[model samples]
Target: MDYLLTCDCGRKHTVSRKQADQLIECSCGQSLRVPTLRGLAKLPPATEGADSPPGDTAASTISKNGENPWSGWRGPCMAAACGGLIVSLAFASWYLLQRVSIDTSYTTEMEIAEGNKIFDLYTPEDMSLVWHSFESLGIGAKEPPLFIRWNRYAEDRARRASIAGGIAAACGIAAAGIWLSSRRRV
Candidate 1:
């Protein structure tokens, strides 16, 4: 059997069972007594709050393959990122749909406003001519027209939101794929 010895210089050395209790020169030039395996086993087990020897801790006890047992979070983090992106995309899509409806309604209102010459681009006498022109064009409507401006702001917002949604969707798909691949490897 092999006995483990820890030197005050923070070095660990393994000695034969027969050499237990014998003084041996450590690589750091210190003469240390080798600990017997039986005595080491007789030592009380470490508790959560108990003080550990130098160079040994609760983290060191659970290491495997030179890695901490709690170090694998890439897959979970990526999945969370993907979920967030999907939620953002859904909101963007809903906003885009709402903008489209607003744009259509605004456009129809602008057409009616043009038929009424609401911008004062013509004289009062020309307003009659404009109404005649609308009638000639088969757009006759007795409803008074409005002076509405195009909703360029909503249009621009919808455009930007669509682009953002598309990019987010792409990133979410890529993240999902990466997360799934990593899961398979684990």
Candidate 2:
């Protein structure tokens, strides 16, 4: 049969009576005068100033040692693959902006050159005819004839390509912004 053993610290443990001889101490913070099956088995109730029961001390120690088990650090998405994608899209937008500027410059240069050519191609007599044609075409007095054709090399297919690329780059940047905003775990 199991015999109950009690420590002076008010901890209760069970052991066979044959093994009780090894046990000592009581809840009153007093050591046993004799460690025997009879000496350790039963003790009087708590006196004063004994340490809290061994179990309470053990629990406190365990909690203190454990600290916060959930504490951990999280990483940022800005440092990962999505961050590189954002940079790539930003570069694409810059590339498109440069193209747009080039296209505007080239278009302006071509129009200026064509205006000069149109002036050079006229004579006093031809100017009267052209102005009359402009009126017939419903163009204002200050405007040239709509049918007039002037050519300049700068306003070519390459300039059109630049405008197209700029539009496409703008779409790409929009797509990147959507993706970044929609994503989580950053």
Candidate 3:
């Protein structure tokens, strides 16, 4: 029979009749003297394993031999899932915020060169070069001035990062789900 022993800390402990005179260790690490037969009679009987200490549950994912059904695979899977998710988010954020700039400079030494002489110098977003022609600056135009082109590189970076992050996060989430589902509770 299980005797319900109330500890000094106000925690109820369940002890077997065989341990009535023994000193039982409570969850609080305090030594409790098992109640005598008369005292046990006064207190109600607790359900077997109902009030057992933490990690000592009769019904759990762990077996009676102190082994989890997952065989230690759950913990690592959880950690990987979490790490992947975090990395994915971080990469995605970084990709979104990343912006690269491309700059091009042109200088014309020609005496009749016009600023418009330099055309099709830069490749367009589609990788196509646009050509330009300058027939007349009326004949003797000055050399073309230096030209610079600026574009945002953020778009590409953001796209890559977002894709990578999303993929990673998805893998992490899937692993986490698998790990959780693989666990069996008794």
Candidate 4:
């Protein structure tokens, strides 16, 4: 339930029982102290149509029913969605860095020619088998064939990560708009 607390400037504030004995700032810059629970009970209860003083946006957001608009699932859902957005963007950045690193690795003309020859000789399925075999034998990134394959794999993962990040960003924006609109309803 809410109670009406009158300020010295003649502005009335509809405050909740939880705000008992707390200091509340009035719109006129006056710091009014809410009465204690016993004193508060003696004051008049806020009517259903009681309006907060002008320019009090914080109070305006509270509905007549006394329930906070952002309460319950809305707050938690928004937090989780924002967290997902951050994680998605972080993964996208990491993948993009991996792609750039792989692309800039040193490769001589002779190595390129040898890599092209190996690439042309094997189908994708056969290349995967050969690459795995070479990988297991400790043929590292410096190898022409392995370097080419690793570069391609990194590029693919980067593209997928960026797409996921974009979707997450869109979702996060939409959720924020919805949450704000819900809060503004009074």
Highest TM-score: which candidate? Answer: 4
| Maximum-lDDT candidate | 4
The alpha-carbon deviation from the true structure for residue 134 of candidate 3, after best TM-score superposition, in angstroms, is 8.9
Q: Write the per-residue lDDT of candidate 3 for residues 1-186, one digit (tens) a residue.
A: 666778888787766666666777777889887777767777777864445543323324555565665656666776777777787877776665653332323333441255335433444642232222223223455643334212224446756886877788687777768666755443
Worst 10 residues of 3 by lDDT: 126-135
Off by over 4 Å in 3: 1-65, 69-71, 99-152
Residue lDDT tens for model 1, 19-52: 5566777667788765566775643443333322
The full ranking of all candidates by TM-score, starting with the best, is 4, 3, 1, 2
lDDT score, candidate 3: 0.60
- As for TM-score, the candidate ahead, 1 or 4, is 4
C-alpha local distance difference test of each model: 0.60, 0.46, 0.60, 0.75
> Model 4, stretches more than 4 Å misplaced?
1-5, 8-53, 56-60, 104-144
Report the error of model 1 at residue 172, Å.
Answer: 1.8
lDDT per residue, candidate 2, 1-186, as tens digits?
Answer: 444445555565444444444534455766533246565446433332223323332222222334322232212332333454555556555555544444233344566788989978999899999888988887645653332211122234345546555655655565555445433321
Query: Which pairs clash in model 3?
Result: 95-158, 99-154, 100-153, 100-154, 113-142
TM-score of each: 0.37, 0.26, 0.39, 0.50
* Residue pairs of candidate 2 with colliding backbone atoms: 8-26, 8-27, 77-186
